[model samples]
Target: MTERAYFDELYASSPDPWDLAARAYELRKYDLTVASLPRARYRRAFEPGCSVGLLTRLLVERCDEVVASDLVAAPLVLAAERAPAATFRRGGVPDDWPPGRLDLVVLSELLYYLSAADRAATIERARESLDPGGHLVAVHWRHPFVEAACDGDTAHAEIRRDPTWRVLVEHVEPDFRLEVLERGAD
Candidate 1:
């Protein structure tokens, strides 16, 4: 797993290490991620690794309630200011999942940072947290990077191995991959 201190130091250097709010690529990606949601509205949503809340802000438009979390606190502060309607928390996947059933779970640009075990655990936890027929959206950068434990395809391949999820929407580009899937009815 990516250590918390790594993110702490990154946030300390710059509030927007990813430049999620200013870059056109990021803005477009966030828009596409939100736009790809199969449902017009969701009752409740959870967004892990909601850096600076750029996507969280858009997610708010589609969900009645959004609980967004990050490993570090600095970005969560900025996220709260950007998306005041959504709840913010300091946490990450595999170890930190919200209580109750969620209608939507978003794993955006986050899975690659986790160790293999943590990534698998995170996927399982996400599945368990959702109600049957609930949606889960994942979007990640396609290129290999120094900080990532694996490439985006590798991370997503783990998710695809499960037979219970049915893909509702999929979009692949040179820079990224995005998918929206629904949990199978029990």
Candidate 2:
């Protein structure tokens, strides 16, 4: 897991460490993630690691209610300002999942930051939180990076290994990977 202090120090250095709002790469990636959602509208959604809320704003358009969370408080504050319609909170995954069934859960650019165990826990928690036939979307940069515990390809591979999810859509590019998974109906 990326330590909370690390995230806090990062935010202290610069308000937007990832430059999610200014870069075209980020903008285009967010567009792809939003475009790839299988459902046109969702009753409720959860977004973990919502840095600066750039994508949260777009998610608001597709979801009636969204709970966007981060480990550190500073970015979440910014996220609240950016998308007041969405609920912004400071919490980590696996432990911070909102109560009740969720129709959409977004894991964009988050898994790689977690330890392997935490990553698995987050996936498990996400699956458990989804309502029947609900969707889970994940988008991550494909390239290896120093800060990431695993590469994006490995993260997606881990998700694909689960037997309960069915792929609804997949978009792969040189820069990133995106997958939409639906909870199988019993």
Candidate 3:
């Protein structure tokens, strides 16, 4: 199945398909994601696959403006309802990418859904979209899943290989891996 179809099907049956809002594991993950940021506040932030806007709500507290997107419209509706202030759109990454340079770009539990070529393109677009000294944060489940194209660790390893980004922080837990990367001056 295509990534879009898979996500659409997953959300078609359930609102909180991943239990992202109620799960203790997800809450902890969100906490760590916010904590891992080097800066307390950001001018503008972009969050892709902002499922139910759970993380988007948290991001709005620290960001002056936030632009969030999802491939399926189901979650985007919930996200819009949850965080009406945010600019919510229906589009997938690396193709339906948002315009303008961003100070913070977040890829959380989203990259593994993409094929290798799409994933690499997404990372490349992110690198190009970020302003100098901007931040890029990625968080993903560490374990293997039958549906995922690649494990989180492998995806992160590929992301780190980009010379334009410098790894600033890496948090490893039994459940997930989180990395904070800054766009390099060079």
Candidate 4:
């Protein structure tokens, strides 16, 4: 599990540490993410590492219900305030896997922070919880960062290697990579 202190300190310093709410890059990426979804409406969706719920707000319009979570409670507080309809929780991935199978799971700007082993475990958990024909959308920054354990290419490569998932959409930019994958109905 990621240390709470790290995220706690992050939120203590700034409300939107990654500029998730204000950055034009993030706004465009969020737009692309929501657009990439094949289905117009989903019964249920899950978004882990939902910082301030910027994407969650968009997802709420497309999903009948959404469960968004983060490792620290601070961001979730803001997220809940912003999107009261979406359930917000303070929890990490894999270990804190949510209840019920999800038709859509969004992993945006979150995977690179985990070690390789944890990252793999998180993907596996996502696969396990995904309903048949469910969607898994992953988006991450491509550049190297001292705080990040892996790059966007590396994270998406791992996701592509999973046999159970079929790539549906791939978008690449100088700054980031976004991929939409669907779990096989079988």
- Candidates in order, TM-scores: namely 0.98, 0.97, 0.97, 0.96
Q: Total clashing residue pairs per candidate? A: 0, 1, 0, 0
Note the residue pairs that clash in candidate 2: 1-115
Tens digit of per-residue lDDT, candidate 1, span 8-108:
99999999997878899999999999889888999999999998999999999999999999999889988999899999988888788888889899999
- lDDT string, candidate 4, 1-186, tens digits: 346788899999999998888889789889999999999999999999998999999999999999999998888888998888899878888689889989999999899888899899989888888998999999999997887888889999998897879999999999989899999866
Q: Please say which candidate is ahead in lDDT: 2 or 4.
A: 2
lDDT at 70, model 2: 90
Positional deviation of residue 58's Cα in model 2 after best superposition, in angstroms: 0.4
Cα error of candidate 3 at position 118, Å: 0.6
**Better model by TM-score, 3 or 4?**
3
* 157 Cα displacement, candidate 3 (Å): 0.2
Error of 1 at 141 (Å): 0.5
Give the CA lDDT, 0 to 100, for residue 80 in model 1.
97
Model 4 stretches astray by more than 4 angstroms = none
- RMSD in Å for model 3: 1.1
- Please tell me which predicted candidate would have the highest TM-score against the true structure: 1
Residue lDDT tens for model 2, 127-161? 88898799999988999998899999899899889
Overall local distance difference test of candidate 3: 0.90
lDDT of each: 0.92, 0.91, 0.90, 0.90
Let me know the TM-score candidate 2 reaches against the reference structure: 0.97
What would you estimate as the lDDT of candidate 2?
A: 0.91
Off by over 4 Å in 2: none
